[model samples]
Target: MSDLNRWMQKHNLCPENILYLYRSDRKTVLHRMDGGEAALYAPMHGVLSVLPEDQFLNISKGIAVNRSQIVNIGNDGVYTMSDGRTFQGRKRGLSSHRRLRMEIGLSDTKPRPMSMSLLEKCSLLDDMPLAFCVIELVFNEDGHGVDFIFRYCNAEMANIEGVPVEEMLDRSFYKVFPNGDKKWLVSYADVALNGTKHTLHDYSPEVDKYLTIHCYQPEPGYCACVLQANEP
Candidate 1:
């Protein structure tokens, strides 16, 4: 484990007060408007996952700035912050936010996607405090695991991934996280394909959080995973 994982502490900050996030090596330093810094040993993208998507956008692959902190977003792929600091946001990120602006005029373009079979089995679990999701396994012709698509995601599951509930539904796990650990596919596949119920404790260096994942097959080719995370 990295030093961040060996010694993790929780820091609660108001989302609005966050000014910018800068990643140095594997540690992400949250530079606040008040000159305070909260450091987390986590991947940049992983940290971005838990922020308010509407308020935070990646300036570059290595940096994400709060929308409130931006002084102006220039047409030249550069953004200036209220703190007199400027950084280049990725063109793809800017385009995505432009698309996000387009989504404002539209309302719920599609209904939330869910798997009835998984939903039924999920109801059997009486865990109100944990985050959980039901996912369908995607496989290659060789029957090996490739990815899992979200069939049903509870609100808490969205909090875990730092995405909104509607945004996660019916989305590919790899699509959202292109470089997500392959071990996750293996773990979920073991439960879904073989009905092997199990649990695992994992520490995410990227998000600087500890996780306990409880997995079970809700139906063939589908599994439900209960997630509990903290900065302990």
Candidate 2:
């Protein structure tokens, strides 16, 4: 069976109860309610396309949040999940908000709730000036690292890549840039698996730019990177 199919069978992700399918670099995770608490299934990619459209909505570039999972929407463009974690909406003027409200069948003038958390505050990174991405390490069955996936990237990183952020979501690093150094993949895997932080000054032939990257693991199996583009 394909990895996507395997994931669906293991998670019992039926159309009836799943709240959303969130994409993070290499995986598409299922978010659902289990016994009044939010449960996230294991991450797998390529499953979103098969889900029923009437039940899911693509809220942001890489995030397809389930309509039932939404508990509140704030005037400040914060979406509060049933589990209390918040995700900021993409900034494309007021129309984005209008579109979201329309998709969820919500009135535009609804009152904004006053609940916000540190995760909501950290959503500001989406608009931050620096280039940032959350990367996940891909491993083989034998536990050897092969490539890195771009789970989440900010607008700055999209600008730096000269591509739409959507194109980078869930894409393997080597597939995106066929000429990228393989050594960087090993470095990323090391940081992700071992939880070591690293800083490197390297030149990217793909974008034809030099970059100073600070990479660290925010959790096991995932690494977050902040980079500055330098002139060659």
- Whole-model Cα lDDT per candidate? 0.66, 0.64
Alpha carbon lDDT at 161, candidate 2: 77
Cα lDDT of model 1 by residue, 14-130, tens digit: 577678999886788888765678887788777666668988877677888887555344444465554445676677656654443344321122223455664776665534567
* Candidate 1, run of 10 with poorest lDDT: 104-113
After the best TM-score superposition of candidate 1, give how far the Cα of residue 192 lies from its true spot, in angstroms: 0.6
Task: Give the poorly placed runs of model 1, Cα more than 4 Å off.
Answer: 1-117, 120-127, 140-145, 205-208
RMSD in Å for model 1? 17.4
TM-scores for all predictions: 0.45, 0.46
Model 1, residue 15: what's the lDDT?
70
* Regions of candidate 2 where Cα sits further than 4 Å from its true position: 1-122, 140-145
Compared with the true structure, what per-residue lDDT tens digits does model 2 show for residues 76-190?
A: 5556554335566665565665566666754433222222452354367898899988877553332222556787788898878776888997787777887877657646755
Candidate 2 minimal-lDDT segment of 10 residues: 110-119
